[model samples]
Target: MAGAVIVHHHARYKTYPGEVTGFVFFACLIASVGGCIFGYDIGLTAGLTSTESFLILFFPDIYRQQKEQVIKNQYCKFDSQELSLFGSSLFLSAAAASLFASPMARSFGRKWTLFSAATAYILGAFLGGVSTTFPVLLTGRILLGVGVGLCIHASPLYISEMAPAQHRGMLNILFQFMITVGILSASLTNYWTGKFIGGWGWRVGLAFAAVPGSVIALGSLAIPDTPASLLLRGESEAARLTLQQIRGIGIDEVKQEFDDLVAAAEESKAVTKPWRELLFGGKYKPQLTFALAIPFFQQLTGINVIMFYAPVLFKTMGFRQDASIVSSVITGLVNVFSTFVATMTADKVGRRALFLQGGTQMIISQILVGTFIGLQFGLSGTGAISEQYAMCIVLFVCVYVAGFAWSWGPMGWLIPSEVYPLAVRSQAQSITVAVNMVFTAFIGQIFLTLLCHLRFGLFYFFGAWVLLMTLFIAVLLPETKCVPLEEVAHVWRKHWFWREFMVDTSADARGAEMRKRIALEMS
Candidate 1:
């Protein structure tokens, strides 16, 4: 929390200059295209594994399992290691790639990082389209995972830096919104392709990823790098012009905001070793904790349990193949529409409100889902439940999906991207992304195994995690709505728990220290 009283100046100027300009929207739009690639992959995996040609080509064991009519346990029918590998390989590579994405963002700038990710995505998609063997298919998936790691690490950071503090939450949520759009698009694509396109449908699904990749690659060239990124790279004039253009404000108004950015950047440059500081410095303890914890809890929310494997889960509950896919589409629709609600209310209602509201809702919905499944299926997991019971379970799953879409889904990205100082921002973001992907990959790989072993108990397992995470949010999280990125440390310093980790350095002392450090570096 050591900073100048410029926070007071920020407070006095209650009215912000930046509105959601067309330029801002366009920039956010382009940045958000990265989400489509991520979401498409998630939605595609559920249906891709279900397709007959895909199974025969790469996983015949699963195809045979699907054909068995001896009333095999509904939970264990699709439990194949090859299918788990196929579903999870992307996330493992993505987790590794996130560690590298930090330095890439810092060295090449956010815009170029996005462009590189898009290129990887396109290449991965093309490879997947042409793949004839399992190894080749997995290689393509790993490439896509690399793309996911880089894209997730950069896209939210870009949007946060580009947006005004007042509107940052909503703009960042645009990324999540685009992800839902991608999921919905993928769901629709799978439904039609699986039904009409016959044996080659999975190839078409894999190839279609190139479309969003192309959007991000071309769009990256068109948008300017963020002012914060520009300032960090020591391009003050360029940063000023970008700040002005994005803000759509008068010269003086632009200068005011630009000066804040300059001060933050100067303080940031004083830190020679950001990763060491992040790890060992007490002042950065809260950020490090938040960076790791938010994503950890977000994954624990069991949103991906639905997003990544909705069709498989539904089919296990007694729905026919086509009905399960349709059910996924329905959940995807709820995800999209619920995210739209977050986009509207996040800035206005603040982050904590949504987190608490959605967490409570998710807990209730998850418990309801668990109870319903236990009662209907019993322990043997031998027979299909009635249609009425299947519909009821789907309804509760929709509730759980809606809860996640609005809260942890977007705010997870929003909080980590905005909370860190410029010095350690990229590093912290990388940590966040890495943690998220690791857990995502973990859940994706083990989900079917859990389904087979735990059967109806899997929902309860997630429901328990949801209960714990909801308490964590209530006790630990501070409201960050409308706070500028540079001033975020102020919020930490004021919090009862996190304040212990913050040093109370005055603005003047911090400024003097920054100046001396810069002079020493220059000399």
Candidate 2:
């Protein structure tokens, strides 16, 4: 009976001890709170900007005389450019801060990097919550953006390094899942608060972001830095100890993995490429392009349009203020649930397949949304649609959200973190994430303005980009399921069509050959 019980435990938990898995899980969970904060900030603005009390308090110029009307239309006095700036401020700040993330992560280590981020979050939330004027509130959001930039850049890098290979994809994607949860939480909070707390509710919601940031800051202290970071710092013994703790195994058991990590670190150090090499030098051009393109396409899919302006979209679809908020909540729920699907299936089904499938679905959904809205409202914007038709627009928007949640949402972070070489991993990730934030800020800044000017045609613009993104993935993205981090460069080098672009020089060819040989021997 004891033997049988032991066998069952082995079957269920695999090689790691239950305690070790639990520890790793706890660490990752705490780290993921940063993602939750990102999501909360995104969702908070969507509902807050549409709330009557928030509008009156912050933008009295826009709120005057329309207070008795439905909340969605109450801010008609504000132009598109003003609304865009309000939504884009956080992302703009994030983009600026992302440029410095690599230096911070390399110099201070991942755990402390995240701790600093949490501190920024706390300060930003406090400033935002207490602000009486627009500039002060914008300043608070800028600080929050700095925090978001650091946390988003570091969280997945830490997770990918620490997690076991078999569980890595799921664990890494968990960061994205936490983001969806934060969005849902914020949406629900805004819904309830907007209904009950009057104008002060938005302030409370914005201030509440500090709670999770505080948790992440304190929790980061308990988790050790990644093994790779320690090795990079020449702290071999400390790296080994951290690996032992994370793997829940003894020194002997972790020896092989530790050796592999050290070897990879040494190899990475041997090729000391400057940051400019990632752009101007041809050595890392493929990786640099892949890193930038994936995240850029991710934003172009128009997912943030829904994330940042769901209530506004719903109003355009002809829903009432309360109904629009409720519909937005439904989209948030779908986003959270679909991300769970991605987390469970990422490793099993592979990244490329999900991207292809999800991209196709997103394209179709966007087309349908554009068609329905255009048909109802007309190109010149002089028609009205029935409630039934408006519901169709809402349904398709939910579908697009689901498609994105499971595909680009998770893969955007996962692929970039895994594909870059260890030496340039932090720098490459920062670049990609910075590019992501740039596009996010651009979209957030212009989406409402486009809606006013383009009306139903706005969906068509995004649909076209979705179609282009699908083609881009089908052509360039390679499957990276279960590939060792050190061999990721080989996967790109081995691509059937893009091999020339990825393998530019004689040294790269030799390096790729050597990595392939090593991968075979390890297998």
Candidate 3:
């Protein structure tokens, strides 16, 4: 509570009024389907590309190469522009779509924006399932990427707005938790489909994405819009009612919470062009920096290096295709379980602690994997390491994935969603989603090439990044645990570094008056 301004309102309340309730839980569950779909796409695409049917149909050259085993370097075997385009194109389109997600969410509401995202994802899945040509498949990938953009932008925001302050971190993490669930589901789907369904298994795997898409689409219709979003839309009475409903309290019971929401919404009204203010407003420098940097650093953790291409990496490491796909399932399981651990501890241990601990684990895992690969393959980077060695590498990769599942993976979305004021919340989140995808696209495109050329050095590069981001968190990020969204500004303004940039004359005056009033009451 250092640098906090504590104001007592009433005998019944301590600071703010909110309790965990079923309505909010239901809303979070539905919104979390957005993460599931995104994860399904990531997990399915990696294994689908490695499938015999998918390769023979869309990438015959890669299929021939897989059969030949003549490429000397296993790492370079699947290094084809066509395959890279298929893997990376979705991310590029997602980045593009994220730029527009904020405006769409602002105009139509978070629920409908998510609805549209699910619809787009379903269409993309259908197109991919029936594709007769590479262009058609590529088109489908881009379409689904667009769906991911909108969902990534809206879902976390919706959850953060609806969740009570006490449980916000735990609740917001459902988005990441669902993502891990989807990855696991996709991995199991890929394993079973490839084993039993024969040549068309990849199609079934791709089509199954529609199942989660349908969940989000139907679920979006049932959930109420967030009170903050309703307030921003000038639906005051509706906002009040929704707040009461979600808080599971009577109208009079929600009055203090309603007033706080209204005050935050009114503060946002003065900024007519949030985007312009976000980029140029000196006061928003910390928020703007955080929006761009957190996601950027999250991607640099190279969690996607595994998430996007686990089966491929395993194949290079010497596992047979079937075994490689199954190995991905192991990692997926670790990711889900680790993220569950995070949901339990994030509110208690705090964000910075997890960031530092997880980053350290990731660094150690990355360096160990890199050193092993270097010794096993020598400078040739061609031979498959022993079966035992390959399994060891998989274990290390799981360590890295586990570290990410709990920390950067969820916090990347949670911090950005909770940090910004309503005025620039959407814009800042768009920046976060877009930056993340852009880097993801870049990684997807160049990873094989880097693996081929850098050999054992690829892991080291990511390990270095983990080190830097860890230092960044240790030095710069303030603990935001259990703080109300509207009260987050005080935390920033009182920080040793961010305080200098958070200057607001009117806000300072209000804060001073509240402090003085509280002091007098205490006396």
RMSD of 1: 4.1
Q: 2 or 3, which is superior by lDDT?
A: 3
lDDT of 1 by residue, 1-523 (tens): 1111223313421224678899998999899988889999999998987778888888877787668746657777777777877788898899999999988998889999999999999999999999999888888999999999999999999999999888999999999999999999899989988866458888888999999999999999999999989888999999999988998876666655676678888877878788887888666888899899998988888888788888888877778989999999999999999999999999999898898899889989988988888888778887668988888898999999899999899999999999998889999999999999999988888888998888888888998998888888889887788887866776787778988878654542676465446435433
lDDT tens digits by residue: candidate 3, 1-523: 1122333221111245557798899999899889998899889988887887788888888888778867777667678767877888888898999999999888778999999999999999999999989889988988999899999999999999999887899999999999999999999998989876458878888888899999999999999889998888899999998988888878766765676677777767767888998998676899999999998999899998798798888888788888898899999999999999889998888888888889999999999999988989876876768977887898999998999988998888889999898879999999999999999888888898899888889899999999999999999998887778877877787778998888685744554465445435444
Predictions in order: lDDT: 0.86, 0.80, 0.86
Model 1 TM-score relative to the real fold? 0.94
Q: Where does model 3 exceed 4 Å of error?
A: 1-15, 505-523
Where does candidate 1 have its weakest 10-residue lDDT segment? Answer: 1-10
Clash count (model 3, backbone only): 0
> What is the Å distance of residue 498 in model 2 from its true position?
3.2
lDDT of 2 by residue, 112-223 (tens): 9999999999999999999989888988999999999999999999988887766778989889998999898888888888867446878888899999899999999999
| Candidate 1 clash pair list | 4-507
Candidates in descending lDDT order: 1, 3, 2
Backbone clash pairs for candidate 3 read none
